[model samples]
Target: MNTGIINQQGLVFLNATGAPVLSRADSRQMRAHITKSNFAKRRQRISQVETKGGESNKQTTQQALHRRKRSQQKSQRAALDTNPTELPTTESPPCAPSLQLLRNFRYLVFLDIRPTVQDPVEKAWFDLITSEPVVFEASLAGGMRCWGPDKESQQNADLHLSRATNLLVDRISCEQVPSDAMIGAVMTMAFGERLADNDVAWNVHMEGLINMMQQRRHHGVSSLPPVFRSLIALDFMNHLLGFPRFYHLKVVDMLSSHGDQVLSKLAPIPADLSLLKTAVDAPETGHMGQTSHGVEEPLERVRLATRALREFNDPYVKATSRSLEIYLNLLWPLLFTIDLESVGSELKDAMSEFRIKACPYMDLTSPHYILGLLATEKDSEASAWFLDRIQGSVQVMRQRGWSDPLSVMKRGLVHEPHIHHQFTALLDDGINGLM
Candidate 1:
């Protein structure tokens, strides 16, 4: 038998009309020729299609670019029509203009006044004054005088003061009182003097003035002048160190010696020793409207004690020691108050006792240290206990609308990233290591 083969477009054809004819060489040659022709045709088609697709894509992209350009031009034209005076004719440079040093000086002065101004109109006036280059230049000259040592420096200082006074007078004349700006100017003068360490006399005079302002007992006085009260508190704390006998006296004592007078002027004093003993010793006293067992309610006792401790007069060392003791004593009941089956109340008691013993030297600033101590025995269990207490306190605060110390501390820890970092670092150190 013989086979005949035909080839066209890279395909082999069998010529089987009449007798069959077969030849391997003829079949191989025919297939090769047909394959080559078909491959060339497919390649050509692919190349043409790719070129057409590329051109179509390019056209679409160009159309989009043109549309975007037109939209931007329209926006710019509309902006010019709406605000012709403000629109720039030419494209602005990418680089920003350098801030003038004088302008910066004015900004600082303006910011100094912003917090004190109650009226929005007065605030806006101060803002305008600060934004002006002339005001800034005047401020810079005055600031420089705050340092230079010469008669000319004194003249410059006087000129700056005159400029500020004139600005203030102008505002007043315009029926816009410059109370906020005047206070800011006064504060700046005091602060500048303090920085220079030039004259203690100015500080003394200011202190006297602040005291006089406070004596007026106006509603605004409390918000207006805290400087004098702060200084008095600092001095009182310092003086207590020298006079150990009076260390028990609180910062409030410097206001007036008579407890009745002081109490009348401010918030009510926390219950006295007599009142506290009565409340604890006899539950019937129930000043806070809670029937108590022989044991005091920890949170209430802490609230009262903290207030009393703040008011306590004593040497710094003795007062702080007493305050710690009182605080620890108030917190001691939490050990028994917790559910023993769930949290191991006996361990809690032991931890509380340990804290009480360590209270003399323990730094309350680092809360993680306290947490570590709690976790020393059965860490997982202790963490659970601490978390539970926090939840309970949060619940109570929600119900009563009054925050507890733990809640305040927890919020602080969450918001302050630095504190949180420190806390986590301390936690990693292990509770037993702290002990």
Candidate 2:
């Protein structure tokens, strides 16, 4: 390699547009002035190279450049393993666009791929730089150019998303034995849908993720941290809102036992999530009977779980109220399914409070099955707002992907408010499928 060209290659772009530039030597000096911890080593390396008095200037510069590159690679690897903000200052220009793409993806989803990633994990998640789903890849390329400076990119994003949605449905249908790459692709597409303002696509992508979780849980670390934090919360939210849960509560137990377990039991004395399943089953699995001696067993289990949750407190923990909120909300469905008339009076205030607290985690529209059911009984502001939202979304619901809660809301109980028989017929199918 020509020494002149290698020296020029060391110069780095100062901004996203690659307009401003700083000579590699000048940037290294500036970085040394700013950060003593890392640049100190660079300075020491420079000194050692300088002290070798017999060496020619060409050899000296080459050695110094090699030392600098090595240091940067070391620091970059460390930063990626932990906090990426601690990135090396000596980044090369060749990798700039690819690096920028990664930064955008990370900032949006917060899925940093931080767990003990092996070959399989790396191939799936990290390979996005080379091969992401067409949808997300287009959406990202579009995002980079979508600002006022580029109208074509903005239009391209729309066309890409429209085509992407169609492609995603086909992708989901075909991926029966989903690989990690497919999971990562689904995750990427979901976030892209969020960015593009495609709620219907976003919701559909979310359902695809849950399906992947069910299909692929046993392949690797099934109870991934996000699985506990995100999916369990989703199940609880839907369950509480009076929709059948799309995921099982026991997955929380499975997550608690294995995987990147980020969730902590919030109940000061948290009950086993299995207790939730046990409580529901105690009264009746398929069909619940009238409140008799049999009712006390399930009710007591509910009381203990509720009491633990109500008293829960751990300031430092994430999703502190999560376990409590999801649990309390779940009780509404089980209790109401067993006896609807009294459940309304009992869970009225708690349900209202829960939607307020848990709204940050899942889509507000998706988690309000209970709200729709309650709307059938009587109209409150919460129920009224939900009804309006659902009414407006009838078109989206009619789509093939929005089958679960949409079907329940439309052809069944919520569609005919006074119809008690539809509710009874749904007892087994709704909770099992939904949960």
Candidate 3:
């Protein structure tokens, strides 16, 4: 109970009272005891002060050292993993990712099941604009869960995309594949590449995809992935968006079927609009190639293809849905903003009208880039609702060790130009609840 290191001998001397004055040796002992007691008291006082000050100093010192060590290790790892002199590439792997390649193979096996969506043939032109952002946002949303880090998920995504591209390219070059296999192959590639932002190689991939679809059109294929309709819709949407013609969805007359001179319609642009639009007449082409009755042939083809992918992966959030709707919602506005002289003014007007109709009706599950579009419009009602929902969802994320979702979106949506202040306010509202 006592903090003082008391001596038994000192207690005995104190108890001696008036009986110890006769002996000189006793007097010396008494004086020595008093001196020792005073020294002990001063030492105790000094130790108490040191204990309080030492603890805070130790904690601060430990934290600083840990931070420095972590920073150094991060720099070292960066130097090791990255090539300072070389540019990073998309298709050519730094080395073959056997595990990722295997994963891609396994994924194809699972995805080839009977179509669930209403079409199959139109899947070649799957939702091109929104796919990339959806993939991107899913990876970010995925960062919240107990799984591999974001970089690993991204690599896994890249692995599937690159592997699919290679497989399809090889399949197209080598020989004829079963119709079902062709649909499955294109679906796999589309699924892999849809969420890849500004991935220009999609045209080459889509070109091959359409070629496969064309070869398989005569024979009816059983079981289409459900997404086939949306894919075809995306192809039309891509053409409408003034992107290059990555697909070959054209209509031929009965005369052409009889081996007569067939009318070949070319898309006015390259499937990837990021590249220069090809020199082609817009008046001669159709965004969705139409048959004699103004029906897109892929309409039925897409309908059959859509039936292929039946079951859906349960999405944890609207942003992670297997369907391309969420990203499409974001893509429409971005597409509307593009002023392409090559595109028919009617197409541009239609897109603008569609964007306006859709813009005010975004649901909570919309991609984060919708915030960028919302910022561009600065719609008071839309902003208030979106900001409220975002605040509620991401507030809980902080407690769960997630980085700010708004900040995440800030980075995700940077490709689109908008009022920086308005966007910043939205981010601050969700992050700091400033709104």
Best by lDDT: 2
Instruction: By TM-score, rank the candidates, best first.
Output: 2, 3, 1
Q: Give each model a TM-score.
A: 0.23, 0.35, 0.30
Query: lDDT at 21 for candidate 3?
Result: 13
lDDT (10s digit) by residue, model 2, range 122-188: 3223343223244344334333222212343344345545544565566668855554445545555
Off by over 4 Å in 3: 1-198, 218-226, 231-424, 429-435
The TM-score obtained by model 1 is 0.23
Model 3 residue 281 CA deviation (Å) reads 25
For model 2, which pairs clash? Answer: 241-369, 241-370, 242-370, 244-434, 245-434, 245-435, 246-434, 247-435
When 1 and 3 are scored with lDDT, the better candidate is: 1
Question: In model 1, what is the error at residue 218, expressed in angstroms?
Answer: 5.7
Top candidate when judged by TM-score against the true structure: 2
Model 1 RMSD in Å is 32.4
Off by over 4 Å in 1: 1-142, 145-155, 165-178, 204-222, 225-435
Query: lDDT per residue, candidate 1, 157-235, as tens digits?
Result: 5555555445544644664322332433443444334323334633543553344334333433232222223223222
Compose the digit string of candidate 3's lDDT tens values, residues 1-435.
111111223221111111111123432332344345446654665565555656755444445546656776565345435422111111111111223322221122221123332221122122221122222122212221211224433443454344445544565576654333345445444433433333454455555555554555545332222233322332432333333222234322221243321111112212322221121113444332222232334333323332332122111111122122222223333322322221222222222222111111112123333332343233444344445545555554343334543343334345433333545655565445522
Q: Using lDDT, rank the candidates from best to worst.
A: 2, 1, 3
**Per-residue error at 337 for model 1, in Å?**
26
